[model samples]
Target: MPRIHFIAIGGNVMHQLAITLARKGYQITGSDDEIFEPALSNLQSAGLLPKELGWYPLKITSNLDAVVVGMHAREDNPELVQAKTLNIPIYSFPEFIFNESRNKLRVVIGGSHGKTTTTAMVMHVLQQQSFQFDYLVGAQLNGFEHSVQLTDVPVIVCEGDEYPASALDKRPKFHFLFPNIAVITGIAWDHINVFPTFEIYKAQFEIFISKIEPKGTLIYNAADDVLKALVKKQPRNDIQYIPYALPQHDVKEGITFITIERITVPLKIFGNHNLYNLHAAYWVCKTLGIDARSFLTNIQSFTGASKRLEVLLQTNDVTVFRDFAHAPSKVKATIEAVKQQYPLRHLTAVFELHTYSSLSTTFFKEYKGVFNMADSCAVFYAEHALAIKKMPPINEVLLKQCIAQPGLSVFHTKADLQNWILQQPKEYTNILLMSSGNFDGLDINELKNNFIHL
Candidate 1:
């Protein structure tokens, strides 16, 4: 096994990759400026946590077999500089993953949203059918012990991210994976810091479609008008385009069910967006030799990918959920999903301005009426987060005006949010928390425990 050094290894998937490699008997070591919870604990549990915080150029010795750079590291990072100077084989995780699976049949799930869940859905059904495959998902999916798995396998499923691969690479991660089968959940403008304009953000997907392996199959969401137009705009006669729409599904008393082949199968997940994602998975599985009925039968057990509409607590009276939805489109979709599922309940939605895009004053306007579906909505953006990101303080009035929700409440402090959540009516209210980041260290399980007896 090679000695791999991870530069800025505290990232969600980076840490998991380090763990997987170390378990495979590779000598793995990692360093980061600061490591956060989950990643911090996970690395320590794997005995791979760096002994010190921050970059150490000295650690990038000439003997190191390779230097794996994470997106968190800057181009001029001291460790990266050292690795470059030493001529160490440098690669981003995506680049490395693609290289490792070059000989495998790759299924890359790309889009602005729903990549994680859709990839999880495909992986779940494949595993259930006893298929041997590798995968790189963005989140910690239930039943899967790790997020990145690389080995001698014929098939590799990847959650293709549009974020820049690495500071050094400067290309979207998905661009690195030339897939035999590609899925686009939908195109939504996001990562405002990188792709500043929606057109520029979307152009990456166009490139992605062009990069698909010759004669590759493209499964996309036909419901997204922008994406639909993009697919139609391109005349790639070499590839097969398979468009998927939301399947026939109905919600019955907070439970969602989908129909396939004249048989009804109940689902643990909700949302029209999720139903569309399921269809994306359904098509991919179908292309990979899994029958439609088999895909549906096994998908019944896939509760969901973690933090993407994950149910935190549920009781007779109160139901609490948290999701990794920070973008305007995602927030709108999540709010609608929860509200539609529990239409009878008084929905109290809480959102955190966690991403740089969500915190931007310009991007705030994109959130117009996003939370309008919720009975009560509150937005939380930590002043500390703004200061750390070096972003200008958000104008509270402008934010409220942008959201356009008359009943919306804005909170800068977590204590205020905690208090607000505690005060929401217990018996008839369904609390939904949406953010890619933890609400500035708010404990969801603890919050759920408070309403356990209700």
Candidate 2:
């Protein structure tokens, strides 16, 4: 069995990969400065957790087959430096994933938002069809055993992230995958700490398109004007390009159904954005030879990926959903989904400004008109987050003014946010909690229980 050591294993995907390899009978060892719950507990459960935290260069030996590098590790990370000194092979997470699935058909989903949902949808349909395939998805799904899987399967579906691969490799993660089949959900400027400009951010997608294998297929979202223009500008004669838009659908009361010809398919997921994701997934599956009838039939059971508009609690008159929507475009799409799903209900959208991009004052203008659908809107940002990111203190008044939501409420404390939520009227209401952070360790289940019972 191959022995692998991870430089920074506490990352969500890194830990999962370690556990997966351990389960596959590989010898796995890892180190990290700090290990958080879920990742810590999961690694411990797998018997792959390191005995201590912090880097130990002594663990890097010539006997190790390879070192898997996590993006969280710095260029000068002691173990990483040691591994290089020892002449052991080093692979970024994406690099290793591509290495493992080099012989398989790679379907890489890329975009700023909705890629996870789209990837999950594709995985769901393929699993339901009982097709043997490997996958690496961003979030935990209903039937998946782990986030990363490696087998002798002939096909692999990956949620192609555009973030930097690792500290040593500054290229975008998806660039290394070199997908045979590529899907771009949409492009919105993100990761400002790295790209720093909208043009640079968009250029990454162009590079990704150029990286597609010769004569391979490119599937994209046609409804995204920016993405559409980009695709049109680059005419790839060797590649087959396919664009998908939201399929014709209906929302009756609270359920969403898409009708095609004489067959009407009911979906467990709601929202126009989700509909668009589903359309993209359908095209991907179709390209892989799954018939349109079987694709729609199998997709009916896909609720959603975890934390992507996941409905946590529901009552006869009230429903509460939690989503990972820290970006501006995602925030707007998520709120619109709930509003469009329950058109009669009062939608209360609460967003946590948690990510580096969202917390920075420079990117606040992108969110100006994203909250018009909410009957009531609240924005929360932990004060300590600013200190952690080394950003200047945010003025709540200015933030509210910049968001341009006249009656928006802004809070810097978790307690204040909790109180506001508990005090909300419960009749005919839909509550959406959107964030990439935990809202300063807010227990979502407990909050949902309290709200639903009240």
Candidate 3:
């Protein structure tokens, strides 16, 4: 059996990868300063959880075949330093995944948004048809036991993130995949801390396009003006371009039904963005030889990737949804979707400025009219987040003014935000809690229960 140790194994993908390798007969050991739920519980259940917290350089021995370094691990990490001294090979998560799937056909989905949902959609269709393929989706799907899987399958589908591979490797994670079939769902300005400027952020996708293998296929969204401009600006001769737009669909009493070949297919998912995602997924599956009718039949059951418009509670009068939407484009789309789905209901949208981009004053300017559809809009940010990100302290008064929405409320604490939500009249309304973080550790279930019991 191969021996591999993880420097930081408690991440969403990291934990799943650890368990994957363990199931593959590798001796997996890992350490982290702190491991939170889902990851903690998952690692514990897999019997791969570290007995002790914090780094232990002694764990990095010459006997280990490799050290898998996560983004959470710094260059100064003792285990990493010791591994270097021991001449043990170090592999970032993407690097390791690439090595594992080197012989397989890699279908990588890359974009600023919609990658996870699109990837999940493709996975759902493939699984429904019983197509045996390996995958590394960002979220947990209904039937999948793990988020990452390594098998002898000929194809590997991955939700390619644009974030840096690791501290040691500053290259974007998607850059390492060198995909055979690549999909760019739509590029929006994001990861300000990593890419800094919009031009620089957009350039990464261009590089990603260039990195696709010769004779590879590129499926992209033509609806995005920015992405379309980029694709046209940087023409690729070596690869094929296949563009997709939102499919023809109709909404009847809150259900979105797709029209294909004069047959109507009602979807569990709604919204223009999701419709775009469905189109992208359809193209990818079509490339893999799955017919249109089969794709439509299988996709109806895919509720969505976890946290992408996940409904925690739904009644005829009230519905509560949570989404991992911190970026301005995602926030705007999600709000519009809920309002469109439930047009008559009053929509209350609460968002968290959690990511570095969302917190930066320069980037936050793009969010000006994102919440216009919501009847009530509230923004919340943890004060300590500014210090942690080494950003200049924000002026709430100035920030509120920057938002420029009438009757907009800003929250500095979780308790105050909770109280505000509880105070709202809970009749004939839709509540959307949007954040990449936990809204400063606010218990959403408790909030949902309160609304239900009231």
Candidate 4:
């Protein structure tokens, strides 16, 4: 058995990948500065948790067969330096994934907004057909035990992240996959820290397109102007390009009907964005030669990815949704989706500025007008977030002004925000809490219970 050590393995993806590898019979050991819940417990249960909390150079021994570096570790980590000195093989998380699935047909899903949902949709269809394939998705789906799954299956479906692999690897994670079938859901400027300019960000997608294997397929979102332009400019002749758009749909009484092959299918998941995601999934499945009707049937039951506009509490007149939508484009799309679904209801969109981009003073201006559709808008930020990120304090007034929604409100503390939420009259109101992080450890279930009981 190969002995592998994970450096900074307590991250959401890193921890899950470590556990998956350990389950595959690889002897996995990992370390992190501060291991949090779920990850800590999961690693401990698997007996892969490090004996110590912090990094130690001595842990990088010659006995280890390979070292997997996680994004959580800095470039100058002492353990990383020690590994380099020992001339041990080091792999980024994506590099290792590519190495594992080299012999399989790799289907990589990329984009800014709907990659998770699209990937989940494809996986759902494949699972319904009883097709055996490995996968690594970002968000948790309904039937999957872990977000990252590895097997000896013939195909691997991955949610391709455009983010940097690790401190040592500046290349985007998706660039290394060399996919046989690739999907770009859409391109919206994100990760301001990595790609500061929109042009630089778009270039990464181009690189991803170039990485497709010869005679492979490039599935793209035709509705996105940026992606469309990129596809048109691709000089690769060996690749086949497939374009997808929102399927024909009608909404009545908060339910969506998708028209596939002249047959209207009722869908539990609604919204134009989701419809587009479904269409993208259809094309991917079709590329793999799955019947269209069967794919649609399987997708009808996929509620959604965890926290992607997931409803936490619902009553006859009030609904509370929690979403992982911190990026500006995602926030706008989510707000529009909820408002479009419940046209008669007054939407109260509340967002926590949690990401480095959302919290940065330089990038706050990009979030302007994202919440214009909301009847009432509130932006929340925590002081500790700024301190920990080592960023300068953002002025609440500045954030509100930049967002520029009339009557926009901003809060720095969770207590005041929670009180405000509780006081709102519950008639025909939709409450959307959007963030990538918990709002300073607010109990979402408790909030939901209080709303339902009231």
lDDT of 4 by residue, 100-127 (tens): 9999999999998899999999999999
| Residue 423 miss distance in model 3 (angstroms) | 3.8
For residue 110, model 3's alpha carbon misses the true position, in angstroms, by 0.9
Residue 332 miss distance in model 1 (angstroms): 0.9
lDDT assessment of candidate 4: 0.89
lDDT, candidate 3, 10-129, per-residue tens? 988999999998988889999999899999999999999999999999998889999999989998999999999999999999999999999999999999889999999999999999
lDDT at residue 78 of model 4 (Cα atoms): 90
What lDDT is reached at residue 312 by model 4? Answer: 86
TM-score of each: 0.94, 0.96, 0.96, 0.96
The global C-alpha lDDT for each of the candidates, from Candidate 1 onward, is 0.90, 0.91, 0.92, 0.89
Please give, for residues 1-454, the per-residue lDDT of candidate 1 as tens digits: 7999999899988898888888778899889999998899999999998898988999999999998999899978999999999999999999888877989999999998889999999999999999999999988887888899887779999999999888777799999999999999999899989998999998999999999999899998988999999998886999999988878888787789899767689998889889989989989999999997899899999988888887788888888888899988889999999888878899999999989999999998899989888988899989899989999998999999888898889999888899898988888778899998888999766787789854
Candidate 1 Cα lDDT to native: 0.90
What TM-score should be assigned to candidate 3? 0.96
Pairs clashing within candidate 4 = none
